[model samples]
Target: MTTNHLELSGRILRSRRFDSPAGIHHTVLQLEHKSLKTEANMQRQVYCVIQVILSGERFERLTDKLKAGVDIQVSGFIALQQSRNGQSRLVLHAENVELKN
Candidate 1:
C-alpha cells in the first residue's frame, strides 16, 4: 500500500477573511483547548476544524495562509495554535459563511 498521505477530518468552529503578507483568503478552524472548568476530565481536548471563505478578490493568495483548523487527528503533528498575550486568536478566515446549530 502507498504511504505519506495526510487526510484529516475535523469540525469547523470559526471562519473569517483577513489580509496578510501572503494575501487574503477564506480561513477556517477547529479548536481543541481543554475545558479548565472540569477537574476530573479523563480525556484531553479533542480536535476540530472550521471552514473559511475569503473575499472573491483575494481567495488564491490566502489558501495556505488561511490556516484552516485540523482535527484531533492532526493535532500532534500540527503545532498547537497560540496567540500572543492580549492578542485575539484567529480561529478562521472567511468572508461569508453559514453555521448550523
Candidate 2:
C-alpha cells in the first residue's frame, strides 16, 4: 500500500484559472512555504515554492478569495503535473483549505 497525502501552510503567491475539457472550473496557485526544521541534528531554514490546484465547488468558492500573499492552510494529495514536453513536476491537489492571518 502507498499513501499520497500532504498538508501545507503557506502564502499564495499567484492564482490563475483554467477549464477542463468537460467545462469544469479549475484554479491553480503558486504557494511559497518557509520554515525552520531540524535535520541531521542541525537546525536549518527551509523554503520552497510549490504549485497547487483546486477544482469543483472549492474552485469556485476560492477563486476570488485567494488573493496573492494570502496565508492559507491546505490539506490535500500530491499528484504529478503532466506536461507534453515530458517533464515531470509535483503539484498539490487541495481537498481542503482554510484562511489564516
Q: Model 2: how far is 71 from its true place, Å?
A: 0.7
lDDT of 2: 0.90
Report the error of model 1 at residue 14, Å. 1.6
TM values, all candidates? 0.30, 0.91
Clashes (N, CA, C under 3 Å) per candidate: 14, 0
- In order, the Cα lDDT scores of the candidates are 0.38, 0.90
Residue runs of model 1 more than 4 Å from their true location after superposition:
1-6, 22-26, 31-77, 86-101
Q: How many clashing pairs in candidate 2?
A: 0
* Cα deviation of 51, candidate 2, in Å: 0.6
Model 2, position 43, has a per-residue lDDT of 100
Residue pairs of candidate 2 with colliding backbone atoms: none
RMSDs, each prediction? Answer: 9.8, 1.2
lDDT of 2 at 36: 96
